[model samples]
Target: MSTTEDLTKDLSRIMQLAASDPHDIGPLLNYGLDWMLRLAPFDLVAVFLLESDHLVVKAARGPLADARVLRHAISLDNFTSIREALATCGPRLFYEEDHAHGEGDPFDGVLDFPHGHACMVIPLCFGGNAQGIITFDRERCGTYDSQTIQLVEIYAQVLAMAIHQAAQSQLLHQLMRESNERERILREEHQAGDLLSPLQSKNPAVRELGERARQVAPTPTPVLIHGETGTGKEGIAAFIHQWSERRRQPMVKLNCAAIPESLLESELFGVVKGAFTGAVKDRPGRFRMANGGTLFLDEIGELPLPLQAKLLRVIQEGTFEPVGSDRTIKVDVRILAATNVNLQEAIGERRFREDLYYRLNVFPVQLPPLRQRLEDLGPLCDSLLGRLGRRLGKPPLLLSENTLARLRQYSWPGNIRELGNLLERAAILARGSVLTPNLFDLSHSSDVKAGVGESPTPSADASAEAPMISLDEAQKRHIRMVLNRVNGKVYGPGGAAEILGLKPSTLQSRMKKLGLERKVHFEA
Candidate 1:
């Protein structure tokens, strides 16, 4: 066949494959790269697919085809030619000699291509928007003529269309899967008719909270969950999302405290290319991602004051611009925010915006501390044990009656999370199906409560003959027991301070006030 006929046939074949199965972009890309190699002599070919803010190598041909590095992502800022091509939605060419002025080759450490060559980078543009990049590298310099570049651009356009079609198909499939999963969950919920089963609390405070959640779940009102750390705030947020009318849509979560302030804005509101040093492409923020769904912001108090104003605008107007773009994008997102800190106190300190707090606190739900709801301890233990048992491949560890009484005597300052940690440790130490108080590290149970200026009460079944000591003497004895258990180690994990749930400094201060020393002798 003539060259023109071959080129025409190749383009026809590409269209046929793309139209045959829009869900399979892998075969299309692989076949296109092979055909391109046959049409033009090239030492290497690589295809990078745009994902969020980075280009990921989706397919590669030539010597390094099987290299594990192909799976890694390449930031747009790392390559000048690719960035330029993406910015202009066009092709870029780089020659080895162009970097003779001591500027190192861009692909020197990136790819193991043969030295002293030329590379052609074609931005995959569809509908005047760049989706990704396809690069061709030749061992010989200046191998791509004007006609060849034009042909490459045309091929890129075809590939871009196929990729975009496949992406849309994948998204459709994802939506279907989410719908199915949501249906399954709704079916189970309907069958049980209990949305608060996950909370597993019989305590009146928890029951009231669950009832409040049920009442607010059907509304589009913003919910602000307030509690101390480890008080199951996120769990409450998840419960709210599952019970809400928008349960079919995903609930995207972000921890304001986990992300650094410098990057938190872009993470929440997203950014366009050149928005910052590493932003290589336009990306959607959590608000856009959570459109028609719920956005659960954990540790909402930790959100910086500057972003607080932007977040308030989104709540009020349902519109905001990306980090670098002035175009205001509107989204319908249900806000569900949680905070362990007191936002009112933060407002008083001038650290948090008072307006934002009011916006989020439209339907406030405050969770009770574990100590206040001691009646739920037994059920919580059973639930946690069942979960941990299955995860650890062990039978459920049963807590003895005496152990329950012992647990109820001490106040849990860390709440449910601390109880879980302590239970996990005891479960690991337990040799039989039954767990005893000996398996736990509650030696400082009285001391920890005392350190916080709380009095520890004895179990209900304590013998009548037992001597009653002053609170200070009881605290001293408890602290002494914890120190003895760890062999005088005061700091670090598994030490007296950690096991007692007291800060090292606080533990030391209590020890000094009680006239206790590191070398103090104890009864074995």
Candidate 2:
């Protein structure tokens, strides 16, 4: 094909590709680089896209550089030819090695082509401003003729539009992420207020726990929030972060158990670009995101032993290297860890590092389970209802006297979360404003009154000598009663295991040891 025909054909395909997938131009750029090599006299061609004030090799053809070398970010301010070309670019940076016309060009000392006899530069423009540069270099001692230069310049224009399309897509996605992040922050701040409401109540223990949280909030000490699952551990963690000096910054969180063991380290620290197959871009992990704020690691006892050592180092030194990158990054993140599992038990099993446990336990705070502090139930229900009402667009939410009394009767194995979920359900179900006890299904709740799961004590004279059940019998009867209450369901939501605050697997294991089953309630 003629040179003009070739340029027309290549430019047509490039425009079609740009219009089709503007978000990613990798395939288009790579294919275009091949076409450029075919069209130009140069043996080498490279496309340097501007990113954060540096020109990075976006694509290349021939013996220009290796894959790693292609990513090298040469500063635009430092490269004279690139700077001048980009600034006055409808006029190209015409470099002839024999004459030194464009001296100290082509990334100067940084990225010089080994066989460069002469080179031509084309500044890429989008919206009247230069966004990148295209360099064509040849081994033979000869300058580009006018016709070849003009054809190549046409190709450069086509390439520039593709680069701009990719950049715009990236910018649009980034703006959307930022907008969603703002909305999430606002939602959290409101939830934090609700979480703090129980701490402000007349209950002495709840008030004291809040006071301890307030005392520790100002310090940079690492806080360990010890509590059962659904006991508002996350809420207390958020409360501490909100009352701290770094409240204005982000409070990023991660649940250790929720992520797989292999991927947890990268999530906590970070991953460098090309670190693994999927790691195409650098991810600044929770530690970096929570810099100058707090990183709350929920279910912390599930953290594996190997990562614990690295975590200990970060806690002590405030520095960690991202996965696959040797460079150390430092951050001033306040660490807050929560766990339903006993770390001491984990330490005894040799599953957790001893040193990491001590480092994270500097300011330990325990959240009392809801059943233990029944006095706060009224206040908790009120706060949850008001929030749920506004969120669900309901008229109003009210807990009937009978419902509150029944709430106090049940042993809330699920704690505050269960209460909130229960209230939300009630509000959804109710035709009127009043939420009755029937909204809390009998199968999901227990008959254990007063304190949760505590057996009633007999007066000294009445039952001192009465025949007492054996410990095994007592356990068997209790398990049977809970199982019967839930109608033998063990694993799904509203199961007996959940009401008993035990993992279904663990519950099954215990049943095997005690020789119990779904239907059998052992007794005479």
| Candidate that would win on lDDT | 1
lDDT of each residue in 410-483, candidate 2, tens digit only: 56778889888888888998778888655666453335432222234322232232233343444455566677
Residue by residue across 270-308, what tens digits does model 1's lDDT show? 887668898865567677667888888999999999999
Q: Give the Å shift of residue 426 in candidate 2.
A: 2.3
For candidate 2, what is the TM-score? 0.61
Where model 2 places Cα greater than 4 Å from the true spot, the runs are 1-40, 44-58, 62-179, 196-198, 270-274, 277-283, 323-328, 443-447, 450-524
Q: What root-mean-square deviation over C-alphas does model 2 reach?
A: 11.6
Candidate 1: misplaced stretches above 4 Å?
A: 1-3, 9-200, 271-285, 322-329, 445-524
Best by TM-score: 2
Error of 2 at 337 (Å): 1.1
Candidate 2 lDDT = 0.74
TM-score of candidate 1 relative to the true fold = 0.55
Clashing pairs in 1: none
- How accurate locally, in lDDT, is each candidate? 0.75, 0.74
